[model samples]
Target: MKIHLRSSLLCIGLLVLTACQSTSSPSQNNSAKPHEIAALFNQSTPEYKPETEANRTDKNIDSDITSDSKPIVYDDLWQEVIANLAFDIVPTPRLQKRIDWYLKQPDYLLKVNKRAKPYLFHITQKIKQKGLPMDMVLLPFVESDFRPKVHSSQSAVGIWQLMDSTAYHFGVTTDEWYDGRQDVLASTDAALDYLVYLYQRFNGDWLHALAAYNTGEGRVKKAIRQSKKQGKQGYFWQLKLPSETADYVPKLLALSYLLQAKHPKFKVPKLPNYALTSEVDFAQRFDFSVLASLTGVSKNQLHRLNPGYLQHQSAPEGPHKILLPLTEKQLWQSEFFQRYFSQTYTVVKNDTFYGLARRFNTSVNTLMALNNKQTTLLKVGEVLKIKKAQPLDNLMLEYQVSPYLAQEEKKPVLTMEHEYIIQNGDSLWEISKQFNVPVKDLLTWNNLKSSSLLKPGKKLVLHLPRPAKTPKKPEPKKFLSELEQLVKPNTSP
Candidate 1:
């Protein structure tokens, strides 16, 4: 009887998995033994159905199941966030004051959640993968109010608030065309790398590490040294730092508490583990306008996700990345998509993918892939591969899929010429050195006489040389040794 009961339970479990109505054989008899019935349960298979075309083509697959279908008020990511918070910040009056500041703003929590909806899931998901605390996602909120294009008075830029020098030290590339410090995921990665470095530098004390992140590491270290010299312990709380630096850790802790607080005013969105499978990497330069048309995502939306781009187009030098819905990947790969709308379109107006589909006689799924694969539109009068067409989707921005995207204003450059004004203590040679051009070239570029004195604030034209090719590589050690041997051969004789 015990065996029969156990078998019955196992059979029920199997039935639940495959959605089968019964685990029993139709010809079962009362005389059948419990062991025999149990065997039938083990042998039972899930009901099979023909594969649907939707399954064959990912375009039809519903991303909205998680992105939009569920109620927006509840997010499982919050539970995971609260569960993984292991920070050692003790409650203090300063922290409470910061908490009061955050709480006082009626819209602050909502603002954070609203700006973070698209990225928080991905950030939190990555944090979990690293076994780090989930509250790290709140850093961007504290840094730039989640604004990617913001430039601080301190010269810090991007969501991570990384200064140009600091960004380069962390291996983030900054150039005229692109600044990796402003790139959303790229900056996040660099920031985390810096965080890990700081954590190790301070001997695993996160409080001090976080302080160092806001202020410089040297400042924090100096504070520690100064504190120890004054007979105070070299701890984060005890050390005297700048007023803003002192408030920094407490601010983070206060925000951390609010996220974990489960206050009724805050509604965590439904961000699942699979929310960020959309990010994809492309190893070549691509056009964002065509991508906007293809994916039906707005140009503004694309810029928000990839803030590193200085121009509308991607850098001429790339391996670029864009986030597309997972289901759209299949449709993008479909022959139908290739034949009809395989080509790209540039953004003329803020438009929806569905609107473009309606205007161009294409399917929404066909356009979804295009919208998500944006690259760049760098220079004006830039040769566009996709033909120009006035879009019929003027109201498409109303249905924009992305909630946050920075506006990119277009300014026409009338000429290729660059001008520089003379500054104090500047000479022709110094100006030449600043531009890495020969002084002769500078004179020629500006049509200046050799005897002319540079007037401060006078504008001078600079037809700079094209970027230099890499300098010649040093000869191999063995090659140099052989050269020395050749020269010294008479000594051996």
Candidate 2:
């Protein structure tokens, strides 16, 4: 059976925590296996409950910042936040320098203080729910800077930076509508669970566990073996590691330093702890406005709690959440759940099943089920039951393609093209020479004069030669750029 997490950030607050009783192994046996972490939880006779809540601080611990209403004094809390950032994971000088520079950036510090709490809270709660070390929540800062859309050079993505294979094993699907990697709450649970399992395998050594996170466990084991052969301790720092892993711990340490008391040393801002009231469940796709109308929450409040909704909408098939002030939970449950689906719309043009499905903040499969159809294409003039007018301006950001395409030989590769800014003293002539395009053709293509110098941030499109084609009849122009035609030289008729 498919386990669906609530996709919408609507009203419901259902956190699915299945206890594992250890059926078989996570190893493939021609049958789909439960995630290893889930399997482990299944093995326990009684579900394991973390003894302490992750984000709770002793009220008496320092009450320096007033209750939720008051803004935290940066100078007051920077020292504490930095001290709390200590981790055994990373330890490099270059990483230290990076953290220093990162903390010194005023804009970044402000964002960190303001936007990082929900992320911190989500991860910290997952850590506590799974009994993980609290320090691991800081990992996202290094991984994605708490940005949900971060895609790494190695194709690892999301805040926790899971690769496709690992994400699959951990139950994150890379489907058209959902990339579980970018789902902050889901990915945090998966990552923290993975971290705990790794920590157990490494005898609770966080260093080795972290190395497993950076480089796969198999490779880390190999490095440990080599370290032993060289009469070195099998510690992470001593083991031969990938360049990235070698720098990983250092980066963590640097991050810790930046969050430390010397925060002012880097002019770093202190982050305040955000208090969440409650998470309520909305079992169907609904618009943010509906949430506002139902729970008396403003649209801004809902988005603030659920920033992972990239298009400012929820996913389909009835698993959305609307985190609200605890006091509003009953108000939402009493009024919203029974009457939320009334603000519906009929399907219109440019509406694919998925597009309409997403527009309604529901799933394509759900729409198919709702309409009794199999394909994603919708019949023209088909009446779609939309929750709100379709969002015209903002769609999912087109996935970025690197210089190297992931798939082989797609047509019109320019769709993945990116722009390189022209720097000071750059000219179209120099650029064409650098990128190996003819100067006259480049000038004409970019609409530049012969004497015009390229300005910074100018967009240049590099056209790759297409396949050989039949020669066109010669035009009246003196000559065309060779790139315009792809034909073999003719020797004889």
Highest lDDT among the candidates is held by which one?
Answer: 1
Q: What lDDT does candidate 1 reach at residue 339?
A: 45
Candidate 1 wrong stretches, greater than 4 Å: 1-75, 88-90, 264-273, 325-493
Estimate TM-scores for all models: 0.53, 0.50
The model with the greatest TM-score is 1
lDDT values for all models: 0.55, 0.51
Candidate 2, residues 68-93, lDDT tens digits: the string is: 33322333334434433324223244
Per-residue lDDT of model 1, residues 208-323, tens digit only: 77888999888999998998899865767677888988887777777777666655654544455446435644445655665677566676677666667655556666536766
Model 2: lDDT to the true structure: 0.51
Question: Per model, how many backbone clashes are there?
Answer: 14, 36
- Each prediction's RMSD over C-alphas, in Å, is 23.4, 20.0
